[model samples]
Target: MSVKEVPEEYLSGYAEILAEVGRTGRRLTRDEVEGRRALGEQAAESGHGLRALVIRHLAATRVAWPRTTSPESVLAAVEQAIDAFAGGYERAQRLAVRKEEAARREFIDDLLYGRSDPGRLAQRAERFGLRLAHAHAVAVAAGPEPYDDTHPVTRSVEAALLSRFGDRRILLTTKDGRLICVVPADQEEVVRYFAKQAHAATDGGRAAIGRPHPGAGGVVRSYEEALNALDLADRIGLDDPVLHAADLLVFPVLARDREAMADLVDSALGPLQQARGGAQPLLDTLHAYFDAGCVAAQAARTLRLSVRALTYRLERIHRLTGSDPTDPQHRYMLQTAAIGARLLDWPAKEL
Candidate 1:
């Protein structure tokens, strides 16, 4: 190979080693092997191709071998040197990879948690293909089991996402045992696709996408929204595999005033404690009733009760609470209270 293809100095001392081994028939010393290995590591870290380095080392060995030397001993020395060199090269590459991963993880944590200065974070984000100035939306998925970057399910979702998007501005990672994807707000489909892939991979687990928000802090806001959506889904017993925070915004508003919500829950539903079955069955009945859109027949079907039985329960609720669930005006109060109860995990949670 020409000196231009492989650096001339790369072969400088290598040939000397081969010539010495050929002349004396003595095995290369530990220092000699270590020196070549260190050279390999330096070459790798400097972006030199391994293929070129190997070819150059082999060719130098050929030209440096003495005319009368025993081929067996020289060949053994060549094998040992090349093996040591390659081992060093590989070690250097692995170390670089680990460092890169660590940097990327730190950047992600800072970006999502708003721990870094906005200007500095925006500059750092560019290295990872994120433009923090643009609006971004975050989607989070939570499964029955906690997940990490190396999990098979996490890898599968990542592969699926890359296959579709070709590693664009979208970012995927795992945080607090959940999978998260952040994408530019304009690319709504990316976050949706992430949610779909995550839900399928997580085995009936739920995914939530937060509405798009702008700037560095917006990402944190969006991430928190997605997380809250997932939590709210669990508290309310929502069955949908995918949820959007936009649709459920009201729950947060109602829950913001904890004292008022607690009062509402007690005033609207507390009287059910006087019933024979206590509040749970009636609470469930109201849940079914509201979920069924005030359709008695549908609610009865959901509760596995006949319409007459369901009506009697509603009547009993009216008598205890003095609010008829079937009344349009009373329905809103009762429904809101039921939601508040679930959000506060009342009764069972002593809210």
Candidate 2:
């Protein structure tokens, strides 16, 4: 049947049913579907097709009408109206989901950056099903390469965290190049477990967890600490996939006093600044030596240098720096300076 022959009243009734479904945010019910079919029967009696009626009304209401008609053809034109209604409903749901997700991301970002007031944050948190009262720890996860907030790795990490921490108040977001999460505090084991899972899932990414802090403000503190630990892990070449801020407390402590750390770097390793080559090799050798517990043989093997060559370099460091690597007190001073160098990115920059 042709759409031009359908009565305007019947077409209006079908449009009303679709509008009702849209308003209620639900799929068409069986009764509604049946009513649509009845409308189609009436249209058929009036010598009109359901598809034409639907197309005209949808155009009138500013909804996109699907072009495919064969699928609904088998069920006749009545099914066409139902298909159009379903498509519109699904589209509306998708749009709603996108809006909600955007709002959620914004809320989390504000909370993490301390941009939201406590009262407003609490109210928003309640609406989002997040409990901010619990002690919380922040964790940062990343792959070897930089990634955006929408990277698959970030999404995978979020899913893994949710699987483990769904019952608790948890928030996940991505910033800069890393995935950040806030989870209930004092669950070091759970944090590590998910870190390992994310590492495997992302084909060898790693995570750093921060110490638990109380209250909403603590979330930012924990985030900062987690970032520090992540940075330190990269600088010191830690092999562990999951690192805890508590394990590396000294770095952050040293980091807090930049001036003092810079001075230490200058005092203990300043002589290396005049080395023929850049200071990095000597610094690497020293780090390897100290990391090997001041054992020449182990450090040499680690650096792929012969013992005599390692000894020569050590002697050169002693000659240039006037600090004996073999002397326990001097070794302590040099090791501390090396740590400071790493923290300050010394020699790479003017320290």
Best by lDDT: 1
Which candidate number has the best TM-score?
1
Residue-wise lDDT of candidate 1 within 28-69, one digit each (tens)?
899988887888888889888888888888877767877644
Q: What C-alpha lDDT, on a 0 to 100 scale, does residue 179 get in candidate 1?
A: 96
Candidate 2: deviation at residue 318, Å? 2.3
Alpha-carbon lDDT of model 2: 0.74
Stretches of model 1 off by over 4 angstroms after superposition: 1-4
Per-model lDDT:
0.90, 0.74
Candidate 1, lDDT over the whole model: 0.90
* Candidates' RMSD to native: 1.7, 10.4
Error of 1 at 311 (Å): 2.2
Residue 266, model 2: lDDT of: 91
